[model samples]
Target: MKVLITGKGGQLATELIKVFPNKFDVVALSSHELDIVDAESVERSIAAVKPAIVINAAAYTAVDKAEDNQQRAFDVNYLGCENLAHACKAAGCSLIHVSTDFVFDGKKATPYFVDDVPNPINVYGASKLRGERGITNVLEDAVVIRTAWVYSGTGNNFVKTMLSLMQNKPELSVICDQIGTPTWANGLAQFILHIASKYGEGERQSLVPKPVTYHWTDAGVASWYDFAVAIRDLGIEKGILKQAIPINPIPASQYPLPAERPSFSVLDKTETEGSTGFKTTHWRHQLDKMLDEYTEDSKLSEGKT
Candidate 1:
């Protein structure tokens, strides 16, 4: 199988490349190389590569910046997917788009289901929602997997930010009110590969049904404060951090940002698990695994230097 992955240097895309099986021929491209926002470029790339499947990991993911740069967000998130959908349809290949859980407003206290209606509260979420609609409209068989609170050892995510802050600051404050799961990019990457493999084996009807949207995250939930505290303790245990500092829990109002996040955005993964037969690891376990990997990588880098 020949797979083309966008956002080659991103957290999830990076993990995808690392975990991808050797049986498949993968072509991962960064935005500078592929330029998904350019319709002609996307069409030309797909036509030339002639991939069996195109996994769209590219997205405008700056949550707060999306407020001021709504046009750019829509351009990349909405128009980019639209462009890819058209290109995939013309090229006779499938598309698997990675979406976000922010499509929900977070008004509900429970985990969000795939069938639940999306009512995004911020520009980023709204733009992503538009992208989802665009894919469904253009290609009915396209798979859209919505994930949340993603972090990896390779990128500028919450886990890396917390580790940096804990190393420098005496004490830190994180929002306790906002709640969601912290998904390790490795896990999401595996799930996407599983989907691609299934599709390659001509299991498209079973793997991707109508209303092809699904939710995936590591099991368990945590607020920003909880996530930060876990990072601190794990970082220390893994020798990634020198010591743990006092992490004070604060409400969202205490640290307002340009974007309004969902207070609770836990996604229900029942449908995803049932369909794919893939069990999810808990967020804390995944965090520990990631930290361990980070520590080992740091040790190797130091040895090389």
Candidate 2:
């Protein structure tokens, strides 16, 4: 099966290239190679690749910056998605769009379900929600997988940020009130490949249902402060960090940004679980695995030096 993935160097896209099933002839395109914002470019690229499936991992992901760059965000997030949907429709291929949990306002104390009404609190969220709508509007068999708090062993992410900060500062403060699950890119890549494989076999439509919008995250929820503390503790345990720094828990008000965030963005996976029969590992466990791999890589590099 030929699978074309956008955002080649992104955390999720990188993992998909490295770990996706061997049977797939994956054509991973960087933003420079195939800019989705250009409708003609997308159509041309899709036509040339003639892929069985297009996994759209490309997105405008700067949460705070999207507030000021709404035009760029909409162009990439909303209009870009619409372009991809049209391209897929034209090519007779399926699309698996990676969305976010930010589509919800996070007003509910419980987890956000698939059928729950979306009320994005910021420009980024609104843009992503619009992208989701655009995909479904154009293509009936598109899979919009809404995920949150993605990180990985490679690339810039929350884990890397926390590790760098802890190395430089003796103490750090992180937002404690805001809550969500952290999803590892490797796991998400696997899940996406599974869906793609099913789609290639023409079995996913019966299993996933039409206009599929699924929620995916790690097994447990945590506030930013809690997540940071875990990174600090786990890094030390795995020899990925030299010191255990004190991480202070602070409210979101203490560290205000241009964009307003959803205080509680936990997504429910009941529908996804029922549909795919796929279970995710806990956040802490995933964190440990990533750190372990990081530690191994560091050791090998050091030995080479």
Q: Candidate 2 on 40-150: residue-level lDDT in tens?
A: 999999999999899999999999999999999999999999999999999999899999999999999999999999999999999999999999999998999999999
Writing each residue's lDDT as its tens digit, candidate 1 over 1-305 gives 99999998999999999999899999999999899999999998998899999999999999999999999999999999999999999998999999999999999999999989999999999999999999989997999999999999887999999988888999999999999999999999999988888987888987677648879999999999999999999888887889889999999999999999999999999888998998899999999999889888888999999
CA lDDT, every prediction?
0.93, 0.92
* Candidate 1 deviant stretches above 4 angstroms: none
Q: Where in model 2 is the C-alpha error above 4 Å?
A: 301-305
The global Cα lDDT (0 to 1) of model 1 is 0.93
Most TM-score-accurate candidate: 1
Q: How high is the lDDT of residue 9 in model 2? A: 90
Model 2 quality (TM-score): 0.97
TM-score for all models, in order of appearance: 0.98, 0.97
